[model samples]
Target: MRKGKWGKALGVLGGSWGAPPELCPALTAVFQSLVYHECHFTNGTERVRYVLRYIYNRQQYVMFDSDVGEYVGFTPYGERNAKRWNSNPGWMEYKRTAVDRFCRCWYKTFTPFLTERRVPPSVSISLVPSSSQPGPGRLLCSVLDFYPAPIQVRWFQGQQELSEHVVATEVVPNGDWSYQLLVLLETPPGAGSPTAARWSTPRGPPEMPPDAARSKMLTGIGGFVLGSLFLALGLGFYLRKKVRGGAGGRVPPGPERLPRQPGLSGLLGVTTHANTNVVDGRKAFIILSHGFK
Candidate 1:
């Protein structure tokens, strides 16, 4: 490989114009290799997205061909690249190795020209201090429910784990089966509210104003009452309709009649004292119309 000339050519053609000539050869090799890998990809945008998914955060990278000058380097997969990249039992291990190799290669070969930007892996813990009065309250946290089973929960006051004052309650499973662990901390002296004053000791609770505490309890009760009222109203309406002989709604046509049971008719009065034995046609029609009701 022609080092000096190749480096300059690769730097310019590979889109690494800022890189010095000495570093060109290494950058060129990486660029060319990436290009070869990307050749199998049909969509250029997809290739770029795939590279970005693995990289997490990316810096400027140029591509070089052994014969051609420079072009953009990218992965063959799209933004949803990881989904396309098949994973198996050993896939995760392979990915870790690849990341280490890439980091080492970029650091050694590119040096000052190819700056290695470190993006720290992040884990966010939303600290919700139970009612700033250093007392019994629930600390709720949101987390992904599926895939990785058996999550870990820990409580720390500043640096040390809170042993005496804290207890992890039952891990409640949500409707979706995701788990949430509530940490209950008993109130201690000098415990201040989360929003109020800061505590002198790391473990002590913050004192919340009495009014604030009262208001929180009242709000919870109010919500419960409202919910109960709606439930009761729904249930009462259902029962009322059922009890009123199941006939309280819009009236059915007057002609509608109940079918007589086979044996039940004999138990009822079969009264008949027929005084109008002589039936005129007009009188019979009039009686028939009245009976329809």
Candidate 2:
């Protein structure tokens, strides 16, 4: 009976692609609640994924039709490390692992859709100040959606249908087969109300910046950074070894060569005088005084 209830609840919250349409309202509420919690904060996708994974694992959900093959069941807990079925971990472990894997896989598959479709962005003002100031209000909020086909953008305030004031001012075509809608609002205080406002869009609210779309990009690059760090360290070590020891870590200089002196004997082509010297084999020459001559 408890299992049936869980199944019903899951049906409402939503499931893998083939989930049946006969889902109970309670089940739908569960999915709604998941969106409510998941979409309210930054990094909510990660939390939602983790929650879905937990639910799928704990529920022992079947991933595929039994007609395709044997109906493997789920094991919530992981397998014992040593227990083996012909070198493979036993059946229970395998089943549990499969469930865990599917949990991760399905979360990856559906969480974004659930987030995009379910919550829809809400740009609302908590309070509006008087038109006494130049600005529209304390904060006049708006939301722009770039959803693909079958999804439309609409605006609501306090559950009343706002038609004339609301406008689908702009539709920008994205290369990715999506259309962007810009919704605008001008909230200023009126005679009695704390907040009063209307919507404005020549085309629509400004498109969300590309940076906003690329949230969590750094997390993806983290693995590459680790690998690069290791490579750099290895190269640095090799270079240090090649350089040997020196000031400022530069390579030490090699042995110096003696500078060649000018060889007067070779250049002048004079080997010996061939004269017997008086004291140190010197050649004697007589010179007359030029000036006197």
Candidate 3:
């Protein structure tokens, strides 16, 4: 059996020539037996194949290919059985020789097709505000788009490497053969204290200042709030003016005149005894005519 570049099984080959009747029964027995042998081969990003089955009892060992990686191993009982059977020095040496021969053959067959595998990661660092249970802030270090899986991430405060208040997530696959890891440092509130995040896959280290980060966040929020408030007030004033102008038209060419009552005219801009009496009489005459009509 051969697997395609994507690790999927391409095809299967089987032959049953010159096999004895006892061999068939033994193969069937091996299928039900717990003892087995398994082998796997892969070319990193592309193809993979697996062969697994009971070693004896009338069955030829099964072989298959798949798009996904496969893991096969004997159970504890099978392991104990093998150990007991191979306890003799001759059997042990023979088993080692067989395994070595198989490995040599597999290497010779597949090593030429394996591609070069090295991919660097993209690293980013951020300061996230967190609650004060552990600290007042958190420094997040993200390593993304890396390959080969094994990576180390570290946190530092000044020249000293920090272990306390540090949390790291497992290496997560990105489903495209790349991986990512997130590390967080719980930083204490301080003034201009610098924290650094370091990673093995990515070379350079990035630094973050606690005070600067917090101040920047606050500045952004304050600017947004102040801008919104000014906008609201401007909109409100414009709407109010629009409604008043639509209803009342332009101001009549002077200071607005008030009704003349029994109050004295000490109020500034208040004309206590102007020609409003004539104006009021005309307005009353117009209202009375309208009412009568």
On residues 1-293, what C-alpha lDDT tens digit does candidate 3 reach at each position?
A: 33353322111111133344343443332333333444454454233333334443343333211222222225554455545644666754554454346544665676554322445566666657876554445667777786657767776555577888888999999998889999877754243334455555322332233333445666666666666666666667667778887542233232222322322112211111111122211210000000000
Q: How does each model score on TM-score?
A: 0.18, 0.19, 0.35
lDDT order of candidates, top first = 3, 2, 1
**Lowest summed lDDT over 10 consecutive residues: which window, candidate 1?**
284-293
Q: Which stretches of candidate 1 lie over 4 Å from their true place?
A: 1-147, 175-177, 188-293
lDDT of 1: 0.35
Model 2 agreement with the true structure over 1-293: per-residue lDDT tens digits = 99999976676556433365565543432332111111122374333221111123235332222122223323423122212321443654444444336555665677566543322222332333646666434333333333332323333332243444443445565565444445444433222222222322223333322222233344345545665666666667668766885332333333233333322221211111111111223222111100100
- In Å, residue 122's CA in model 3 sits off its true spot by 1.2
Q: How many residue pairs clash per model? A: 19, 7, 11
Give each model's whole-structure lDDT: 0.35, 0.35, 0.47
lDDT of 1 by residue, 39-85 (tens): 22224213211122123124323332212322234544332333333
